[model samples]
Target: MSRGAEARQGLTLIGPPLFYALIMLAAPLAMVVTFSFWTQDYLDIDTTLTLDNYREAFSQPIYRVLLLRSIVISLVVTVTTVILAFPMAYFLSFKVKRRKTLWLFLITIPFWTSYLLRVFLWKVILGYNGVLNSALQGVGIIDEPLTFILYNANAVVITLAHAWAPFAILPIFVAMEKIDRSLLEAAEDLGDGPVRRFFRVTLPLAMPGVMAATIIVLIPTVGDFITPKLVGGTDGLMIANMIQVQIGRANNAPLGATLAIISMVVVSLIAVGIYLAGRKFGGRVE
Candidate 1:
């Protein structure tokens, strides 16, 4: 085919997806950005551009506190999920000799159910009169149910970690599978012990997957309101919950848009920082 014809054909193939993204993603993002600079009255929106929303978002102690809490909670969930996932991914990638597909299917059984259902299930398991309390009582482990296990930041972290576990595992498993086994054998031949070999060869090569899993888990978990709403109680509520309130009951679309914009900026900065830091560390290791 001629060059011009080839270019036209390529554009034809990608045009639908590009248009879809423009409508679905870019257009909504633009609206949010525009609204962030606007003001909201009780019954009407002031379309005139202003920084009042951003100012309030920054000046308010509650917004700052919630934003920080959201970041911390997300970090906790990301670390916990990745750590827990690593072992399963490792076993599947290196140790599983048969039925890996079956094992993976079982791992993903949780996804087959609705995400809200999973959150509710965790709530039930952790509630005062729930399965965990009943089991502990039956075993005589405690005279009273543990109130500390539910309705807090800890509960939020646990629920989010559990919810995102499979997401973390898949990326790491793919990364592990891509690793050259010959490098590991060579390390062993050079008198490297199992632990040393893993640190030098396996872990370094798997960093990309680990980083991918971290980003995937961290970003969504930070914005997650459903889990926190269902199981987090007051102490567990994150920025997303506050945003929901602003947009819904509070009827302050401008403020909600501002908060959402700020969140996206903060997440973008953190993600960039993490990528840079990881790259620097990886380069030093090399």
Candidate 2:
């Protein structure tokens, strides 16, 4: 076929799905961006463009605190998930000689149930008289149930980390699997210990997967409202929860949209920063 014909044929194949994606993804985002510039008064939306929402989102102490807390919580969850997942991924990739598929299946067992169910299960485990406290009491470890575990940021972190574990593991596992085993063997031959070999050879090559997992766990968790709403009480509420309140209870769509936009911008910047940092580190390793 002529190059022009081939190009046309490719466009024909790509056009529909691309259009669908734009409508589904881009349209809502564009609407939110638009809404951020307008003002809403209870039942009526004023079409007059204004910076009030943006100003409030930036200047208000509550918004600032919530946004900061959200970032901190997301960072903690990402770090915890990745740190825990790395060992499991390494075990599956290196230690398991057979039934790796079964192990992976087990890792995915959590997904078999509803996400709401998992969150509720964590709630039950962490509640005052829930399974964990009950278990501890049964064993006489504590005279009373712990109050710090549930209805707070700690609960959010634990639940999100657990939920995102598989996401972190799969990426790192794939990266490790792609690594050439001979590199580690060669490092060992060169008098490098197991730890040294990993840092020099295995870890560097697996950085891409680590980066992927980090981004995967970091982005969505930042904007997660449901987890916080269910398990996170007032002290645990994040930026997303504030946004939800603004849109739902407060009936301020413009302010909510502004918060959402600000969040997307912040998350995008952080994600870009991480990507660049990873690339620089990878380059040095190379």
Candidate 3:
């Protein structure tokens, strides 16, 4: 086939899905961005492009606090999940010699149930007079149920970390799987101890997976509203919760769109920074 014909054929194959994606994803995003610049005039939208929404998003103390809290909660959840997941991923990749598929299947069992059900399960475990507290009382560990575990930021973090654990594990496991085993043997041959070998050879090569896991966990956790609503009481509420309130209860779509845009921008910048840092570190390792 001629190059022109090949190009046309490729376009024909790609065009339908590309158009569908633009309509489904790009159109809604563009509409939100456009709305963010306009104003809500009581019963009707003011259509006039203005920075009032953006200015309010920045200036308002409540918005600032919620945004900052969301970022902090997301960071904590990302770190907690990745740190816990790394050991499991490493074990799955290096220690398990058989039934690796079975172990992975077990790991994904949580996904079989509804996300809402999982959140509610955690609530039962963490609630006052619930499983954890009841077990503790039965064992004489504490005289009373603990109130701090649920209906707060701590509950939010624990739930989010659990929810995102699989995401963290899968990426890191894939990265570890791709690592050349000979490199570890070579490092050992060069008089390197196991710890030293892991740091110098295994860890560096696996950085791509770690970076992927971090981004995967970090981005969605920032915008999580349902988990917070179910378990995170007032102290645990995130910017997304506020966005929900604005759009639904307050009936202020423009302000809600502004908050959503600001969130996307901030998350995008953080994700980019992480990606660049990972690339730089990988380059140095090479």
TM-score of every candidate relative to the true structure: 0.96, 0.97, 0.97
How high is the lDDT of residue 271 in model 3? Answer: 91
lDDT (tens digit, per residue) of candidate 1 on 1-286:
9999999999999999999999999999999999899888777999998999999999999999999999999989998999999999999999998998998899899989999999999999999999999999999999999998899998999889999999999999998998999999999999999999988889888888888888899899989999999999889999999999999999999999999999988998888777677666544311
lDDT of each: 0.91, 0.94, 0.95
Better of 1 and 3 by lDDT: 3
Q: Give the residue spans of candidate 1 off by over 4 A.
A: 283-286
Instruction: Report the CA-based lDDT of candidate 1 relative to the real structure.
Output: 0.91
- Model 1, TM vs. native: 0.96
Predictions ranked by TM-score, top down?
3, 2, 1
Report backbone clashes per prediction.
0, 0, 0
Query: On residues 15-126, what C-alpha lDDT tens digit does candidate 2 reach at each position?
Result: 9999999999999999999999999989999989899999888888999999999999999999999999999999999999999999999999999999999999999999
Question: Which residue pairs show backbone clashes in model 3?
Answer: none
lDDT of 2: 0.94
lDDT of 3: 0.95
Q: Which residue pairs in model 2 clash with each other? A: none
Better of 1 and 3 by TM-score: 3
